[model samples]
Target: MLYDLFLKPYEGYSTLFIVLEAIAAFFGIVSVWFARRNSIWVYPTGIISTVLYVYVLFVSGVYGDAVINIYYTAMSLYGWYVWLNVKGEGQALPITWLHRRSALFTGGFTLANFALFYIILQYYTDSIVPTLDAITTALAFSAMYLMARKKVESWAFWIACDVISVGLYIYKGLGVTALQYLIFLILAISAHFEWVRLYREQQAAQAHPGNTTTKPA
Candidate 1:
């Protein structure tokens, strides 16, 4: 009943939809796991997920979602470089804490993205769900920026976005999309704890001497 009811219009598109969702889910989970391990491959996997979702979301009339995916693609590339080249003086970029400046910039970017999405959705798409679209758009942008900077709070934001996104996908009758978001929710929780552990270990390494010199490797 559910699949049939939700999938009536997209029956012809089923194969394509399922394929994209499967690829997105695979890459999204891998990306999150890589991020928790502080690995550089996270960005490339993330780009794969977002780029496919951009095409998927656009066909679903989710203009804001498509736009967010575009930004995510760009963020993935930028994050790839930042994760590789960004290093502090003596410590290397050891999951640096979010500074006051970054917080302010992220907040400002979220607000601007929200406004821009709202206007686009309202004027361009006949979507009554524009408000929800804008909210998720802003949340995703902030979360990506936080993730690029290796902020611990990025996981929490992603968890929230996944939860809401699950509902949105279900409502939009995208069964595969809903399933992907559910998987994302679980990974987001994992990321939160993993990063917290890394942060604690990082702090400990700073406080102690020879014993603290050991790395996560």
Candidate 2:
């Protein structure tokens, strides 16, 4: 049953492609795990994963996702820089809630991305699942941006994108990738709550700086 579900889809595919997917999936999971812990390593691990998936998705004819991975690679670099340089002295960037204005901007940006990719996929590419691809790609783009900004809402976008991508990859005969997205869905949900808690802790720390353990007795 396991073989039928996972390996069967790759019966005629090259072993190299299958191995690549597995490796990419591994790094992707590690990246998300780092993000959950609010660690700086997330960007580096995510860069590796996204770079691999850019090639994987392009070869598989998922042009929108290929583009998303390219964007992810570029954004990962920017995010890494922001995380390192924008911190307060020795502290990391504080996880925060998205502002109302930022939320509205993200919604508009996602919709625009969807329309743009849909048009390109429908006209320029021979993509079979243009709508699904565009939707997931757009959602992921917003998620990546918000994540780099250290907003808690980024996980929400990732949750939605992962849910759609799980089915999308299944339909595309990428069983391993489909499984990866399912795992991503779970991790995103967990990360949302974790980030929320972390945000609250940040607020508490700001409110009670004197209560820190570093305070002299």
Candidate 3:
């Protein structure tokens, strides 16, 4: 039963393609794991996964996902630089909560991305799940942007994106990718809480400088 549900789907695909997907999935998991730990390695690992997925997802006819992976590649480069740069003296970029204004901007940006992706996928491409693709892609785009800035809300966007993508990939016959999203969902949720705790710790240190020791995020 499990074989029929899982391995059977990929029986028609080439071994090379299957191996590529698995490798992409592995790097994707590593990238997110690094992100959860607030490590700088996330960007390089993520760039590798995203570049691989850009090809894999494109061949799989998941055009929205392919496009987002392309965006992720560029964003990873930008994020890497942003994460490395210091503020005031030489302190690394700290984890921060999205303020009200930034939250509003993110919402607007996500909506715009949704509209653009929907239009292109629906009319321009022969995409099967245009709406779902657009939804997940838009959410992921914003999530990537926020994550580049080390914002706590990035995990929230990732959580929503992963939840929707789990069903989307399953419906699209990408079982392995669906499983990846399921893992991503779990990690995103855990990362959210961990980041919140880190943010609070930073706040506490700032409030009581003499009593609390500051840690790099």
Clashes of 3: 0
Model 3 is weakest, by summed lDDT over 10 consecutive residues, at 208-217
Candidate 3 local lDDT, residue 129: 97
Candidate 2: residue pairs that collide: none
Residues 1-217, candidate 2: write the lDDT tens digits.
6777688878877889878888999999999989888888898999999999988889889999999999999999988887776434446666788889989999999999999999999999999999999999899999999998889999999999999999999888888888889999999999999989977877788899764312100
* Candidate that scores best on lDDT: 3
Give the CA lDDT, 0 to 100, for residue 194 in model 2: 93
Cα lDDT computed for each candidate against the true fold: 0.80, 0.87, 0.90
Once fitted onto the true fold, the runs of candidate 2 whose alpha carbons sit more than 4 angstroms away are: 1-4, 211-217
Candidate 1 local distance difference test against the native? 0.80
User: Candidate 2: minimum summed lDDT over ten consecutive residues — where?
Assistant: 208-217
* Pairs in clash, predicted candidate 1: none
Ranking by lDDT: 3, 2, 1
Those runs of model 3 whose alpha carbons end farther than 4 Å from true positions after fitting are 88-90, 210-217
Model 1 C-alpha lDDT per residue in residues 1-217, reported as the tens digit of each score: 7656356646768786868867987887787778778777788888999999888888788778888899999998887777666344334456756789877887788889889888988888877589888888889999988888789888877987898888887778777678778888988898899889988888887787554322222
Candidate 3 residue lDDT tens string, 46-98: 98899999989999899999999999999999999998887655467889988
Model 3's lDDT to the true fold?
0.90
- The per-candidate count of clashes, in order, stands at 0, 0, 0
- At residue 144, candidate 3 shows an lDDT of 97
Error of 1 at 81 (Å): 0.3
